[model samples]
Target: MNSRDDFTEATKIKLLALAANLCSRCRVMTVGPTHSGDQRNSIGVAAHICGAASGPGSKRYDPNQTTEQRKHYDNGIWLCYSCSKLIDNEETFHDANRLKTMKANHLAYASTLVGVALMAPFEVKNEIRAGIIEATLALCGSGAGKLDLTAVLEGYEDHLKSIDPNYEVEITTTNRKVRYDITAKEGFVPSISIIPSAETRSLLFEKFENLRLTGEDIVIPSEGIDFVGIDIFQELKKTNPKSVIILKSKKHKIESELFLESDKGIFSLGSFQSLLKGGKRVQDYSGRALNGLFQYNFIVDLENEKGTMEFGSTIASWIGKKLLDIKHLPKLLKAHKFLEQTSSYKFTVECEIGNTTLKIPKGIQNQPENVLYFFRRNIKALYLLNEISKTLPIKVSIISPVTTDNSIEIADFSLLLASKPQPERLEPGTLLFNSRLDELPTPLAIDLWCQRENLYLSVTEQYNRTSDLYGNLISFPRWNFGFENFTPVLYSSIDENDRNYIFVNIYSNENTTVAFGLENGNFELL
Candidate 1:
């Protein structure tokens, strides 16, 4: 049946961020403010501009309306808890015409403030540009603000040693400034100089006035802490950054192909020379338009002045967002809301189950037996995540030891089967069957992302029309094996999206009915 009551991932995110997650009716959140960062601070609900249901509560549900007209961005409003609740008290108050007017007016007010955000002073714009870089680093799932300079440097040095112990990269930090001392012979000195204070950073910029260096000479303008990445043996083609390997901190291991993921306005080796260069006036922004600001920055800012009228740390928040302070990172629906810790790379998530909320930590979900439990508890969130996954892939694997040894990682599936667990493979009531094959479908082991030719795993779902509890016909029961590092590489939309699959029922026995696809391998097809 056709329905107009659904919101796409993109539309929902737009309504929340643009509304600054504020309530529309009262212009005040009765439960709490957006500052607290708690999902509990979720007093602002994205109400349908027209009613979404045809039942008792719906005031303007149109059964004949087309999908586009019903779910359009204009068909939504951000309202606070009190207003959202009261609108239904008197059905006529929230009539379609009245609600539409409120949305239009609220957005117009938000637009004026964004005009200033876009045309912020030169100093402030620089801060925003810097924020983009810092945000990318934070995407590595680590506490990036208070960086471990020594650890980052050492990781780079170790990578260099692997190239050749004789090849050297030395790192030293003094007075909050960091310098990479790469002792090269025969006059070709590799240098990575991190300038701290504005005076020195400017002085260094002056030196680059007429000089342009190769990608080897990366002059990263200091945002704070030194960034040396998976730099060794990377594609020196320089134009396209493949992946980076930064050294790990003595205490924390930094692992991810973060900088490699290609996306729009996401990653760039942006120049900071604009700050150093003279003669550029803050253009005439007298028009004072929000759309102009949005188009200019290519970023969505959901801040409003009303929310700031009642704040003690607005200055601090501004500084952090402007500068690349870890504390005041950009809050978008795209980013993960993991738990905080004093010092750790991974983050825990707080999710409610039934009436009780539980903290789902990283280490806990990675366990084989606990995988089902995690999926069962967070089914709704995971479903939303899967929907959102169309835009951004959700990487749950840990790139640790099980994947470090490349030779072992690419081994045939049959060879690695002995090391895997062989217990109650199927849930108690799971249906099982066995069918003989003409030939053993070559015991192949592919990466998590391999060029495969299948979708909708051919087993349980095809027969019973029932995917596992998580709705995933194929999944990695455990992420810390050869399969952890694999990702399905799909070149075109037409190609199959499945990867890292292993056929399980073929290997199941009466005693060990592993119908759950419990057996783990790099192949995604089960």
Candidate 2:
């Protein structure tokens, strides 16, 4: 019941942290400073669940204050800096209707956070407090937070699906055009348009070039003219000279047509519609008409089967490529790491549609040229995976299926012991070979590099981005480490590739549990 002005800075910070943590746990605020980096000197701002101008008796109003007192976190909802700024600066947020919507959102988030905190044990509650502090500071520009890739991809996919399903999709290449016949299904034939932000026309064209054709065929007409007997004989004379007497009759028509006899056959309007329905036609063209104005014509009726087959093949090839391109999406989860080594680690993993590679500590690797290529490919594949996960009914796993044959052996801890202890009786502190973050002892320092790498791989492969920043310097709490009575929490990885070197308190106690290898330099722990 204390008024906002009566609260101490320390108390305010604690309350803000609690609010942010509650919001984060409820999946309201996914990405922010509090959830991404170390927790210290971080501050979270409070937002009103109801408008600041709401009546004093309202739930959002700070009841402990006088009628003129401004309601803040003491009786309002807490928000990250970005949200606060968005509310204050963006005209949309200030709209009465929007304010009402925001109030509902804030109240829902607050109610959920409170529920989660109440159900959690004291230790977990402390962690939640730390998380909130980190979240708060992150808002105040002191920490970072996790990327809500799951929510992002989900929203994107939902939007894509919500569009009218009957729109016909098409891709045009230098040699051919591929079409999707959506009208045949009795749905609105959507005008062909690609999501420009996600893909480019050139990429789609290139994919079309590699498609494979299947099923029946159709042909294109020449000069927009309907083929007659005379035209057929004239075409025959140039392509097949063996005929002694080329007879022409109005009733006689060529059964097949080829590009070699380009002038003989013409397409009818009905045939044009048929070709489009079959997804074979690209675009309408014209050559000659009654008043010197060329009449629009569709390609149909070939003289040679080979020419018809080639045309169909080209269209089919383009279709195949388009399907593949649509299926794969690139992923871009930010990861960070810090190294003192002149030599770097090059991580490589192949995804469903392409490969993913990264060079940690960029210049630390022997082959720096390959690093960029690796990063680019993986980034692309990750995006594809993220996109595909939205539309397709597929479950992407977090664990990499493509693991080194010696990964199990390499992960074994007994091998690291000088006097091989029994596996069953192995105590904590048993070092697994170059321990990844997961295998460390309970009190060990969490390896940020491993966490980032693993999270990236998991997001790309498993469609799961849930991660634990426990036992790491970044996730360490101020109280547990005997720090300056400040709150602590995990922040986001640095950049997109280096998932290590998280921003942490410079004042926290140094612990060696988490260590990194530096070529020509000693290993150090925070």
Candidate 3:
């Protein structure tokens, strides 16, 4: 492989004699009947079956082959100048059987190689060629190191030129981008770039100063990113608009990490690199591969012991839970924001407000199967806060409608207990009831401001039940009553005093207790 492995003198002599001093394809024997000078010295060229070099663009350069196997007598195929140029144009068509068939047919016509013994039937030859072409196409995709890239590209270019003669390709590989520019005669230029993940922002940093050179180490610095003129980590590069962010993904379970941490990770290197690097196409990754560029890799790094895998499993479960559960959380963004900050005791929420969204993070536990019900009994406290916002002296309860259609809301008890109003600055206890509305808010405003807190108001329209048969004793200045958001289940009747008479029966959700009846037709709240 280090040097050119040409054929033996006997093999070369036999090939030249078989050519009979003529071009192989046309079988012309000689350019002119009695030509002299340089033409006689070079009648035909002894082409190698397998190519001479090792690269993607090289012809028949299988990496697995030894030079001895490649430079054998069977490897030589004789061809004239014109046919040699045509055969070497694309490595895809320059396969073993294709060349064998051409040499056999050419000799069969002129009867050059082996009388008629060496040549096989043409149909049988095409059948074998078809099989080779099929296998080559299949292997070209996943065969890893196999197949010639230049040959494939040359064939592709020939097809493109058939449609447009001026079709041209330009490829540029840099640290920041790998651009492929295709120019067509039809006034169109399509371009694409492949930004390698190995050069992306990553924890694994490379230091040439620390490059530990061993005795056997071959330094090929020219093949790296430094060859390109552009330097990375520039402010302008970060500001440039990007649509794709390629990241490396590794196969989990076998390895210690979730993704095989290659220098190729193209996203989320540092905090500043992600500042203006905004796009919807942030999450796509390469195919599954083990180590280098294919087969298997990991996404997260694991730091635990053998089969335990505690850290990796914990990270995986957390990711899975977030992916599946957070999507189902109530659609309220505020609820999601609040839950994102919470670290302990996950809630099994049952929201009463219609289609509310709440995002909850997975954290601490409630042991013994670890389940906690969302305490919705306090949600009515939010409505109470709403009343506090209007400065209406009201005690509010949720109207659990019996028939779904009767969903109208009315003030349950707008009874002003304090005679002297304080609308300018309501009771100091009202400080807890701040925001009147939120998308999906918790209703624990009873911490500071509620009738239960400071007790600035205590007013009920029921009859004063202190006296035995005082019929109806208490009433508001004026009243128009309805049976909606009101709490206690009560029966009412018009008394002789024309005061509102009410007898309480039952209490429901968020309204577990009934308020006191008016004492002596006098209301004072402080």
The TM-scores, one per candidate, come to 0.21, 0.20, 0.20
Residue-wise C-alpha lDDT for candidate 3, range 1-526, written one tens digit per residue: 3666777788877776666545656664433333445443454777777775676656776567688866775666777777777777866866867777777766665564454443236866776556554443333334423544333444433433444355464434344343333344456553433232454313122321212211111222221212122222121123222312222222112111111111332111111000011122221111221111111111211122111101100111112222113221222222323333434322221111125431111121232211111111111222222323233233222232121111111112332222223323222222111122121122422321221322222223443211100111112232222111122322444776533543432222232222223233232111
lDDT values for all models: 0.37, 0.30, 0.34
Q: What is the Cα-based lDDT of residue 325 in candidate 3? A: 38
Ranking by lDDT: 1, 3, 2
lDDT against true structure, model 2: 0.30
Q: 15-109, model 1: which lDDT tens digit per residue?
A: 87776555666665324445656555556677786777677767678778777867788888877767877886766767888988888787777
Better lDDT candidate (1, 3)? 1
Clashes of each: 21, 63, 22
Candidate number that wins on TM-score, 1 or 3: 1
lDDT of 2 by residue, 452-501 (tens): 22110100111211111111111111111111211223354658664763
Q: Report the poorest 10 consecutive residues by lDDT, candidate 1.
A: 305-314
Off by over 4 Å in 3: 30-39, 112-526
